[model samples]
Target: MVFPERFSNLPEYAFPRLRKLLDVHQAGGDPINMSIGEPRHPFPEFIGRAISEALEGFGRYPPNEGGEDLRAAIVAWIARRYGVHLNADQHILALNGTREGLFNAALALGVEEKARQKPAVLMPNPFYQVYAVASLAINAEPIYVPATAETGDLPDYVALPAALLDRVTIAYLCSPANPQGAVATEAYWRDLIALAERHDFRIFADECYSEIYRNTPPVGALQVAHDMGADPDRVVVFHSLSKRSNLPGLRSGFAASGSGNIAAMKQLKNYTGAPLPLPLQAAAALAWRDEAHVEENRAIYRRKYQMADEIFGNVAGYQPLEAGFFLWLPVENDEAAALKLWREAGVRCLPGSYLSRAVAGQAIGQDRLRVALVAEEQELQRGLLRLHGCLYQ
Candidate 1:
């Protein structure tokens, strides 16, 4: 049997790699895992009831484009959150999760070739692994631009050479970015959008962390594009109830864009995608329709943000997270630091270098750690204090 070679160069997924690096050593004390970004907060109370109420829908095949009720709820959420109104039927496609939409969208809309050559897909270094996989799946060149401190922890796509930019057909961006937790400002979004317009590429904005912030809600890509009156098809924004509503298990999310893009995505989904089960879609609709639970979840994360800052405040080079639930702490050597923390302190964290790839013989996160703040309040505090004493003190 033969397998595809496109992913042969890709590193192992983060969690598995973490295990391989640390599981060989015995934890020095009680284990505290701060590795993965899975939320520890409570999900909405209504989810179970909502799912039970719609149980009968599972008896029949569900719509691949998402049922009308679910899409309408998503549209309403978008309106309330971003002040942008969209037609549910025309502009929304309820997804199994943002990862599904983000990956499959490439297959649906990625150009077969551009500028008379293989098209290119641009993504920030340390980006969601799906972006690179999707890019390779379509036989497009996956350009990994560094999203390091010098660039404000966001990829500066506009700085690339025009000749290279001309080959771009898709650009993947994540705000309140994972692992690093850097939020992009409106100006950043505006500049990126303008660049996309010039280069004739679409922006796949991953705003799954949009609902969990400390202070001001981060500006959104769809909002910026709408404000600038850019072509609606230029930006397809993917959101999920995973981080937003603490419903990752529900696997509910949606992608919103212009009707033409939705049509193309919907067409592809018709053949290859599994629709979010209708019972779960009902629960997801309820999740999106109500904001009280989201507010409560946000409040919990806000407190955690303060806790992280207070604990790591004086540590040299500690960058306070702007949003999202992970702390990207600088260290001497990422893998070594992670191993030492586990072997000596019983604290497990992801190595930042594992989240990124080497470009031009250099990787951005070679000397950092990605610590997830997704534990119970007391447990999170305990882990942070132990990590501080073991790694910094």
Candidate 2:
């Protein structure tokens, strides 16, 4: 049996490739992982209690669309955070995680063809892996725009040729961009939204790391769209408990958009989506409603940001993160730097090329590496010290 050709060129996922590259050499000192973005902070105290109280719901099939309480909680959070009021039942669908929503939104929403040709899907050169696969799965051209230093780490669809923009049916973007930690400001969103309006494409805004930032909270795409009064169908905003609430295990998130888009997603989900279990959904609702836990979580990240600045302050080109936990540290050779860090410094970090695609024969992240600051204070500090001494000196 022959498989589809669309995924033939896809590379191995980041982590497995990293293990192959580093497992041969023994770590030079005590092992510390600054690779994955998993949060090491103490998860909210109430997550456990909430799960225990809702255990009985597991005996029944979970709601495909979120239950009233869970949806209401999510809607309330949006209002409190973005000032956009939405009808909970009509405009939202709870997701197992935003990854599922991000990928499936492409399936449910992207057109197979536009202007009588295979449509295009736009994404940052180095982005969440799902975006590329989502575009390919739908048989669309995956346009990898440069979100590099020159572009301020956000893809500029506004600069794309009008002919190409007209073929775009979907564009995926991440704010507080992973690894880079760059955020799309309100003005940036307005320009992007205006571009979408002109070209008639949809923007899938991945705002998973919106809560953890240094100064101002990153603006939400949905908020900007609401303010501009863009067509309701233009933006599908996805958010998650994984980063915001430090609850990746909860597998809980939601997508909000026009009721029409929600209905299409729900229709697709009804047949194919794996509904988040009822008990976890109940617990997640509590997480969304409570801002105290989120505030504490953000405070922890802020402290880490200060710690990073103190450590890397003297290192030229070390960008103070605007938001999110990862540091897109510059290195002469990312793979070589990663190997040296593992062999000499006992620190494991991801090579930048693993996270990005090549454009015009030049890989976007070949000269950099990603260092996650998700570990506890002392451990993360030690790891950062090792990284700097091994590579920067």
Candidate 3:
């Protein structure tokens, strides 16, 4: 048997790499996991009732483009959250999760070649791993644009040369970005949309963490594009119930774009996608329809954010998270910091370098630790305190 060589250069996924680095050392105390972004908050109590009511639907084949009710619920949620109205049937495609949409959208919409050459996909250097793999899957060049402190913690794709810009097909952006927790501002979205219009590329807006913010709600790319009168298909935004509803196990999400783009993604999905089972879809629909639970969930995360700020306030380079649960704390060496925290304080975190790629022999993430604030309040506090003592002190 032969394995694909394209992915051979990719590092092992973040969590497994964390395990390999720390499993040999016995934790000094009771283990406190602050590594993965899986939410520890309780899901809505009504999810079970919704699932049970729809149990009979499982006997039939699931809808390839999500059930009507689920799509309507998502449509309504978007209107309420982003002030952008979209036709449920034309603009939305429910996903197994946003990861599916994020990866597959490239395949569905990315041009086979541009300017008589292999197209390029641009993503933030420390981006979600799916974007890079998706670019490689299509044999497009994956240009990793760094999202460092200097770039307002966002990738400045417009800064690239005109030669590369002309060849670009897709640009993946994460608002309330993973690892760093930096939210892209409205102006940032407008500038990027203009650049994409000028260069002719699609923007994959990963807004999974849009609801987990501490202050103002982050702006959505679709909303900005609509306001700017950019091409309706210019930005494809992916959202999820995983973070917003604390339902990672359900793996329910949706993509919103122009009717044509939605159709393209739907056509691709029909051949190679697992639609959410009817029961789970029912639960997800209810989750999307209800915002009380989301507000409650957001409140819990807000408390956690305050806790993290209070704990790490004095630590050098601790920028309070703008959104999402992860704290991308700067360190002299990420792997060393993570290992020291695990071995000495029983606090586990993912090394920042694991989430990023090296560029020009310089690893941008080599000096930071991405600590997830997803545990219960007490556990999260203890883990942060211990991490502070072990790494900062």
Candidate 4:
């Protein structure tokens, strides 16, 4: 039997690779997991009641597109958060999670043959693994751009060669970026939107971490696009309840794009997607409608950030995060640093290289480790202190 060549060169998923690297060693102290970005915050208390009330509907099939009420709730949230009003019927589609929507959108909209050559999908080096998988699934070439400190930790697609840009079909961007915690500026968004328009590619803005910021709320891709009067179809932003409402288990998220893109995605979903179950949809609606819990969750993250700052502040080469929940600390080598931390400190973290690939004559994430600040306050503090002592001290 022949295996697909598309996955032949693909690296093992992060967690499995991590286990292989550290499973042989015994932790030196009590374990403190600061590795995965799974939120440890409390979800809404009302989710159970909402689910119980709507449980009967589960016997029936869920709508391929989201239920009207759920869609409206998402619309309202978008309006409140981004000031971009979306038509629930035309511009919103609830997802199992943003990952599903993000991956499926590529299949729905990414056209490899339409480009002057084999289409290229642009993504940050240390990107969400789904972006590369989706690009490969569609037979498009995935171009990994370095999102290192030299580039402000955001991929500069505008800097790509015109020949490559002309062949580009989609660009995946993450604001309050994963593992690195870097947020793109409004000016950055404007430049990117202009590039997309000039090159005729769509921007898949993955803003799942939009709600988990420190200072002011991060500027959104849709908001910037709308302000510039850019073509709505040029940018499609994906948001989720996972980080925002501390509801990762709910698998609730939505995509907001131009009517045409949304329509195309809806049609594709009708054939291959399963929308949120009714009870889950109801729970998500309530979650979206409430901001109090989100604020509370933000407070928790803020506290953890301060704890990380206090613990790692004196350590040389520690780059305190500006947004998102991860600390991207410079080290001699990510894999070795991660192993040492796990073995000596019992603190687990991801090697930065696992999140990125070498591109344009540089191994973009070769000298850093990504420490997720998703544990509880006390645990997070202890983990940061251990990381500081193990890696920096």
* Model 4 agreement with the true structure over 1-393: per-residue lDDT tens digits: 887898788888989999999889999789888879898888999999999999998898999888999999999998998898989998888899999999999999989576457889999988999999999999999999888888988998888999999999999999989978999999999999999999899999999999888888999999999999999899999999999998899999999999999999999999999788999999999999999999999988888878887887887777767788888888998899998898899999899888877767678677888888888787787888888888776
How do the residues 146-252 of candidate 2 rate in per-residue lDDT, one tens digit apiece? 89899998888899999999999998999979869999989999999999999999999999999999989899999999999999989999999998889998899
User: What is the lDDT for 136 in model 2?
Assistant: 94
Q: Residue 339: error of model 2 in Å? A: 0.4
In angstroms, the error of model 3 at 210 is 0.3
Task: Arrange candidates by lDDT, descending.
Answer: 1, 2, 3, 4
TM values, all candidates: 0.99, 0.99, 0.99, 0.98
Between prediction 1 and prediction 4, which has the larger TM-score?
1
Give the 10-residue window scoring lowest on summed lDDT in candidate 1: 1-10
Instruction: Predict model 2's lDDT versus the native.
Output: 0.92
Tens-digit lDDT string for candidate 1 (351-373): 99888889889877988899999
Error of 4 at 354 (Å): 0.7
